[model samples]
Target: MRRSIVAAVVGVTALALTGCAGGGDGSGGGAVEKATIAIAADPGSLNPITNATQAGQEVSAYLYETLMSFAHGKDAEGLLAESWTESTTEVSFVLKEGIVCTDGSELTASDVKASFDYAADPETASPYSGVYFPAEGLTVEADDASRTVTFTSAQPQSFLLSNIGQMPVVCAAGIEDPASLDSTPVGTGIYTLEDSSPGQTYTLALRDDYTWGPGDVTSDTEGLPKTVELEVVDTEPTRANMLLSSEINVAEVGGTDRDRLESGDLFTIDVPARPGLMFFNQSEGRPTNDLLVREGIAGGIDRDEVASVSTGGRGELMTSLVSSFTAVCVGADATTSLIGFDADAAAASLDEAGWTVGADGVREKDGAKLELTFVYPSTEAQSVVAGIELIQQQLGEIGVEVTPAPSSSYTDVIFQGGDWDLIWAPISTTLPSTWAGILSGPFPPDGGNWTYNTNQEFFDLTAEAQQLAGEDSCDAWTAAQASAIGNLEVMPFAESTSTLYGAGVEFEVTTNGLLIPTSLRG
Candidate 1:
């Protein structure tokens, strides 16, 4: 619910994505022909907190390990944290002991403490650490010989286990210079960052000593590749060319180009989960304050059309504010089902509120045009274009004028005080508990969501949910879920599905889900 706009989760360099006209023939995966994979986009700063950019998250996944990981089960091929234990209230982790950084330091409890502390500290300015570590006792007291960090939170949070699974734990010592850690990842995963020439490419070397990997890596020993590399192939056409010419081993191809990648002999199309959505401003005094109007907008958009503009031509329409993984979303489809692709119903509801379409073809009443200038962060060209266009089409049908305002460097602008109507941006969150820490906590007048869409009722519910320490607190959390979605303040969209293109090769490769590169073999 933070106002930080994102045009789309589009890549920067070689990982150009465009949906193909049809589904892939499904024959491109096998035998791991190449270890090096190229993607598009120059990853911003390597710092996990500073690197809010898409590439930063991608590389961060490669170089860091967390107490737990989100990419597990069928989706996550496996990475750090072998398994975990959950009580009604707290989930404890038995670390993936013996994992070490390139600096040769064995992964330990103290390192976990340092990494967790680094994220929570306001000084580090991590855009998202608050979501995972919500408790006070983040200290790591380890058994000198055991090499395991027993991670315990203040309460029993069902989503806490998932949150830690994706967080990248860093070595406080190795990162004496944060810039170095950012430029190169010295992780316990299969691959370590070797070199990065911004705007062109990035390269990685397979860590032969990598002992720990995702659970399903299925290695006899510490199986790995001779080397691994990532390229930042900037444009879509350029990335497709690289794939066809075998200039790169794997890449991401979406939209129309998706057809070419699926049709080409060079690469196999990998579909990770791609979630699309529109985020409403939570600032006070906005029309979003009107629950009916909010519901009307939520019910207005045609998710099928929105999905059509996205990468795979197929996207799961979200009815809840949270993704399908969260508990609140599990049993609460009742609230969500009320709002989905019903422009006729939306129009009727708006008419009840005296909002009539004006001569300009925009809705209006009380002298205000239904025209709302929709804003989104100009992070990437493809994302900006797709997000704005789809939103425009969806809202335009309801006599809503959505003007696309694009800005390449608008991180501050998006979060800053604005006169915006609606914006599309997702704050990266690993757990639902983060709802309290990021959304309600910072998005109002006093916090980061300076959009003025404050709702005290929503904030109090979030606070109440945070204090309860275990799964027993599900009742409170479920309430928060209903309040968030039912209130229609921030509309839920999609979980960004990232993709990976690869040649006939053997390794656990994917776009957005989970990664276990170290366990992969050439």
Candidate 2:
């Protein structure tokens, strides 16, 4: 679930990364002839539901197949179901027949039951079980001939295909034996788990005769990569350095090191990151709680320039929470669609709010200067430095003096209780319709809700959107995004992108939003 992988603080700096010429143990082509991919963050847990990080979900996708997979923008295809008929309140999925698990038994209705049963089982400790098997009556019943799985939600769920699409089917084989699951995962996907060393690395071997994964999944029919290896390397520079040195092929490069790699011929840049941010301290009674201040801050920072500099010039401005291509983002009117850099309007808004520039050049109101210490993590993208610099300049024009307080322990400092004016942090990797599913849905009540939406309207509408599904639900998602932006509770920047460089010229690599290591070749 992209939900739990909250966007960690992105550090902005001006250091160059190691080019492809450095950081390798040159054992030669005959020594290590496999594609090795390194990642900066630890892939939290092997258990899909519990582990929310991309690294974890990336590998889990290899062993688990949801009922339906997505192509560019539509439901592509997947195991368990070929097509689906969706209504406001209910969704019926027609399962694909003849798909066999690696254990050699064909998948059936009972296996679906066991899959959810294991996840819902408290012993499995699957954090994601609630997303799929949450309701009391939510059930997956298999029909004898067509193998249709029928689901009944007490209320209408606008995005059933999307909701169920997130569920990863587990084979009965893994369910029966818990001990073997850790060593050898048995699933109906195209690859089986080969070996994994905790806190170090994991490798997957492809199934030449296997089928039943998303048809649009990266591999080609004629030939596929023989094996996949994932090396656990969390340091930001180390990831970029490894990629440059040809020690690893792919990496989630930090924003700061982007220039170093882009200057060379070895790497390619992906999408610029779109992060959700808390604009002001509602807890403070000063101007930050004021909507005008929040809007000024949002208007103050130039998103395009940040993308260009921090990403080695590979990025696009973000207007909606879910990008325009996603099902949920199309109808959103709450967010800013026309994103750009504007310092004049930002300062004017602050001026209109009664803040005057003092001799020291900082804005002041009732003897207090408009100064804030923004907190960000040190390992965040180099974009952070550019963004912060732009923000300081823009806010200075508005009479607000912004300071940067860098820390690696951003989670504890920011979330625990800190006296900071603004914080740019991400709420989730997966942009779900309801953020509450990730940290705390914005709609749910505070006491009952674990993650607070901070903005009341967004929190309420997220619930409304969840129950609405389809065209109407899609529209609601748009509205919810609007509420988030219009209220200036959080300003979203850009969509996140990754560049995967390989150390060995052995295999072809592709990703369907999930990291499947089985695609690396000899």
Candidate 3:
């Protein structure tokens, strides 16, 4: 996943040292003072129910609490829910005792139910609406006396625990007035939002009463920073410079700057994720709407070269939509489902699709030229920019005129459907069920299906997989994933390991690239 550069921050030199103080919370003798972490951009919304962006989720991990989490890339552990029971159609969780929200309200089962209900509502227009839970047929019930929240689905949903458990839960205060969550956070998290300057900096203070953390960790854990400052630093070189000067505690530096960070004695955390994914707009009159044209575009470029160039020679050829870090079905590769590279076949496919080479050396069909608008995120690493240019040159060899469309606001292009024929966007997930919602169902403004492409076969297979439990559905999931790749709904060609460098802090990141606030240490 790429980060968003909302705006460049001026006077960052002063913001780096804004909250560096000697006095601590007096818990653990104040060994750890404060932490200043550098993120690439502004976390659009502090509201967990409304925001699903990578930067937003990273910041929310501290401000919002989840029912359960995959601890340090391991199995799911209880945080809010002490225990849970699950079946094919229904699952219920028992909330832990003595949990309190930021506003001195006791966290209850009703709060959890309200949070899920609001997020699942289509009127809310959450980016994670269907991605988190099925938007159509979900019934949530809360028993306040027993402190239990029950979710009953109309049909069997696979990975129900993994999918819904990781959702950020909000308090009743935020649920009644959703607008307040956009800037102010209200949850029973380990940290509370103290102050925030959009696109510039965010100040968070640790909760002294917070005892329900991932696994056995708590706020009293040694080396837990009393105050955390998330500073928006957009450039890799600038973040690297801050790390060297001890201005920031942690920052992710990819590309050439990673070399210098590696040379230093800094702590590093790596998570495997797909960084290069290609999707064609199959809406209506686009050239990519035709199967043969999509196949031609697939065969024209060398995937191995694209993977190498895009990740600075630090990526592997992707196998499926799911990342390698996924715990359920590890080592599931669907590379065989996609069309391999062959320049001759690529040109032949275009010719068979009624496209003829014009005098200008560009393909033409019915007075329409085979010109495509390729969109990619501009804030990506320099290597990614070079890789997109390489793709342009490779497709040109087969008489396809490619226009590179770079944008700093890539999410807007994704959700709003800008004037683009093809897009390079990486959709990372731990469960295949999430991909099912993204690939199928309603498109754009209505749901998570942003590509405007659908494969009924893929949807049917995934529905079948959803009925089975845990590892028992691995075969169905593999076939479902292969079906999407075989039909060319989307293509995942390269996988990059996301690296986070820490100067004076040590922490572990979840498989989905979220930092574990409880795992932080000095």
lDDT of 1 by residue, 1-522 (tens): 001111122221112233221113322243343466665556666777555555666667666655543332234323455555654345555566567777787776567656766676655656554465553444434543554555566554455555555567777564555667656565565556777787666677656676665553423343244566766766667777776776766666555555556554432324334344455665565665566677677678765666555534444445444444332324333244346778899888777767788887788889987767677655443843685687788778888777887654344454555667776654443245666555544552234444344666666776676665545555676677566666665665544444455544323433233344543443
1 or 2, greater by lDDT: 2
Give the top-scoring candidate (lDDT).
Answer: 3
- Model 1, residue 486: what's the lDDT? 62
Give the per-residue lDDT of model 2 (tens digit) for 1-522.
000111111222111222221122212123233456675444544555445445556677776667766533233455557778877556787777677787888777677667766766655655454454443346566674777777776756566556666677777777787556655667777776688786688877666556544553333443344565777886768887876676776666645565567644443323224353444555546477777777676777776665465444554445555543343334344445433457788777778787778998888889888888887655566665566666677667667898987765454453445556677664443334534343332222212122223677776877788786566566666677677667765666655555444443322222133343333322
Candidate order, lDDT descending = 3, 2, 1
Candidate 2 local distance difference test against the native: 0.56
C-alpha TM-score for every candidate: 0.74, 0.67, 0.92
For model 1, what is the C-alpha lDDT against the true structure?
Answer: 0.55
> Candidate 2 at 196: error in angstroms?
3.5
Candidate 3's C-alpha runs over 4 A off are 1-30
**Candidate 3 lDDT by residue in tens digits, 1-522:** 111211101111101101111113212223558999998878787888777776788899988888887754356778899999988678899999889999999999999999988997877777766677777788999999999999998979888878888899999999999999999889998999998899899999988988878767777878889999999998889999998898998888777786766556566655654368888888878888888998999999898998899988877787767766666666666668788899999999999999889999999999999999999876678888788899999999999999989877677887776788888886778777788778877777776677787678888898999899888888889899898887777877777766676666666666576678887777
